[model samples]
Target: MLKWILRRTTGKCELERICSSYPAGAERTRAVEYSLSKSKLAALKILLVSDGLNASDAANNIITLKGVDITRNEGFRPALLQCLRHISGYQKLVSEVTRLQKEKYSTAIDDHEQQLLKLWSLLKPARSRKTSKTKRVGELGFQGNDPATDFRGMGLLGLQNLVFFAENYNRSARKVLSESFHPKFGYSFAVVGINLTSLILELLCKEQLKSHFYNSVSGEPSLYHFHRVYCHVFCEFHDFWFAEEPESVMEFSRILELYKVHLLSRLTTPGMRLHSEFLAD
Candidate 1:
């Protein structure tokens, strides 16, 4: 085969050639992903599907199989290890996100109730605490007297995303919540947050987030990284919603589609990383 001929003539395997040729981030990570997916060896192929794969052990397997000389090819090991970490980390993230998505929010669970209350406290610190069952939950932008019903679609993941944003980016979260109350451009803050959570979960499930994560995180992507991405998307959506200046909330579906189109275009760009200017402080 021409590949075998090139391997012998160049004295390096495809992965090594890829590492030496391409710089780190999306391009190199994607190339390594493609190479592993096409590899004839079972070990290499497993790397594409397996979760929690040890990067060092995976690097050793590749080195032994490809006969890479560590002494001469100093960069190959580190490069391959990073790629493996990103690959495995993405898979693990998908699993964890999916698990959260499936977990239904339960009032019987004390932790869920506490997390829900924490979201209110972070966003509405000026207000006095109310029992979890109070109709006041609507002030945060739920449709009815109870906020728990909104979680039926996105499950516990929705609550977690909202809480993470409010807890970690308190100022930005409260700012967006205030913007959502604008008389003309007013929208449901909590509802929009839940919708964005679903959008992000869809992107993650489809593996459309690889480029962003590859460029942003140097190592394994965790739930924290995933939450940060949600925060970025939420902030971006807030700006996008007001910029559109629709006639009313009825235009939400149409506007959301337009925003999603814009987001997908950016995600496909090489080395794209989503970060909010609001987070700069």
Candidate 2:
């Protein structure tokens, strides 16, 4: 077959050929993924699905199976290892995000309560304690007195994303929160954060975020990486919502769909990396 001919003539396996032919990021990663998925070896097939795989060991096994010579193909091992880490790291991030999404927010959970309180403190640092929970939460754009209910759909994942943004990007978070108070263009901050979480979850579930992740991260993606993506989404949505200048909050669903469409189009590019300009500030 042509594959055998290429292997014998070029002294490289299909994976090596793919790796050497394409640069890193979406093109290389996607090709490597395809090569591994179609591999006849059971180990290679398992690698496609397994998480927490040892990249070095996996790379060594791959080299042995493919009869790659280290001296001649010295770059193959490290290149393959990087691809393996990225492939498996994506799966691990999805699992972690899914777990967080499924975890319900509970009043009894100290950590949950603490995170909620932290959000309040970060966004309303100047507010007095005398304000009722309903009124106070409403100011931040929660649907009701209890912000807990707003998190029902996204679970703790939503709350965690908000907290991470507030904690890590305090200035930008506050600026966005302040912008949410614009009388004519205003919207609920917490509520929009939860909605963005749904958007992020949808993108991740559909694997639409692969290009962004592959281009941005060289190693295995983690929950922190996922959270960073959420921050970018939230920030971008904030800008998009204001730029469109919709009649009111009633136009949110339509505007959100437009943003999603634009986002998807951008993700289709070869090396799309989602980053918030606000992060630089």
Candidate 3:
């Protein structure tokens, strides 16, 4: 309530008078309130001056400050409302994505393992062989034969990200998989995909993807949008790794740091976007 009062009030005297309501800490509160009030008064003075008022006249009274605020709010009403709507939609999207991230993968669910196999098949055509599940996972470029163990931290969401990329952007996913097999610059494709999932989840938790989503989405973004971002990160990081020509996968951490810097620079731009073609770059 005090913060709101500080935001709306315009004059030092008026603010000092209002602060007296908190009788419990009258002197201390008044001092704090006085400083806040002056800062706001200074901002309103600047706002008025920008609107062509002389500083002398702008600083004279609270009435001018209220008039300036009313006019400014009225002029920017639609835009402010739009911004609020997108923020609300973003909260919903983040909540749903976070919920999905927490859903642990279960082998008891027969369809889960089948989905994993289907995703692998999409990436590389395979004959019907009676290979064990562990070997099949190994063939998909996981560090170990038991990919379920690899999914321990990120749960089903990690698998979902890998599957989404392969299923939706088959060509790009295959290209990245091929790049991951480069003799001089090889990486474990499944492991790297899982790592990228963790990276993106960190970004989501930190709210660093807000600029990208706010600029790109018209209404509400979704779990699919989150997966699309993972796909982008996977392909782009793959391209970046080869382009840098590192000595080996030993430099994976260094290369990943560079990739993160690259991503953050792009994501912070005024109108950042990530389309399928953009990911191809």
Candidate 4:
């Protein structure tokens, strides 16, 4: 029930407050001193200190402060409660995000599988359908006959991301698909899409997505938010790829690694979000 407040200053992470203010009757405890260095991961942990009170005692202090001094910190209780509430809500939401990401890509053509087909049909209406998965993937500009093979290391999430871009940003998706045919500059559209999926998944696993999602979404970040990000990476990377004009597709692996490093640098900046127009034009 004790909500800890932490404020980051230039070089130190210090405990700002305990329960907003000390309970009136509560014995005065000296300020907790914990110095934080430049280690980014260390900055994320909330310093939880137990001040001789049992867990239940800590929980009770939040509810009934009648005998204690409520006036000590006038505005703190509500604000601290709100912060804790947001953290709780974020934890639940992020759990769901992680769960969706971890769930292996199912090959069985379920409802989502059907959605994938619908996206393809919408994007490539002129392409004739073949009964086999390989032909359908080929029609979408994959390097190989079977699209499922590309998802081997990744999973359903990769395919889902591609379908989402097509469904949500039909014009942009088709434009990118067309760009995949850029005479000398053209690359395998489906393969690159899957590669972008892997790139995004790596970022998510590293928890680099938090700031982007927090700034972008009004509520908790969702699977759709992740897909929107994939769209950005797909489109933006295409732009980057062509601008560099690699001689052959053989440069893809090297260029992709460098691109990831470049992209992550931008994302690591404080308060950075995927621009809305990243899906446009």
Assess the local accuracy of residue 239 in candidate 2 as a C-alpha lDDT between 0 and 100: 91
Identify the leading candidate in terms of lDDT. Answer: 1
Instruction: Pick the TM-score winner.
Output: 1
- Give each model a TM-score: 0.97, 0.95, 0.69, 0.69
User: What is the C-alpha lDDT profile of model 1 across 4-73, one tens digit per residue?
Assistant: 9989899988999999998989899999999999988888999988887898899999999988998999
Of the pair 1 and 4, which is ahead by TM-score? 1
- Pairs that collide in candidate 2 are 134-145
Clashes of 4: 3
Off by over 4 Å in 1: none
RMSD of each predicted structure: 1.1, 1.7, 12.5, 8.8
Question: Candidate 1 vs candidate 3: which has greater TM-score?
Answer: 1
lDDT of 3 by residue, 197-232 (tens): 989988876767876766666544567788889988
* lDDT minimum window of 10 residues, candidate 3: 21-30
Worst 10 residues of 4 by lDDT: 24-33
Candidate 3 global lDDT: 0.66
Alpha-carbon local distance difference test for all models: 0.90, 0.87, 0.66, 0.61
Q: How does residue 90 of candidate 3 score in lDDT?
A: 55
lDDT of 4 at 152: 64
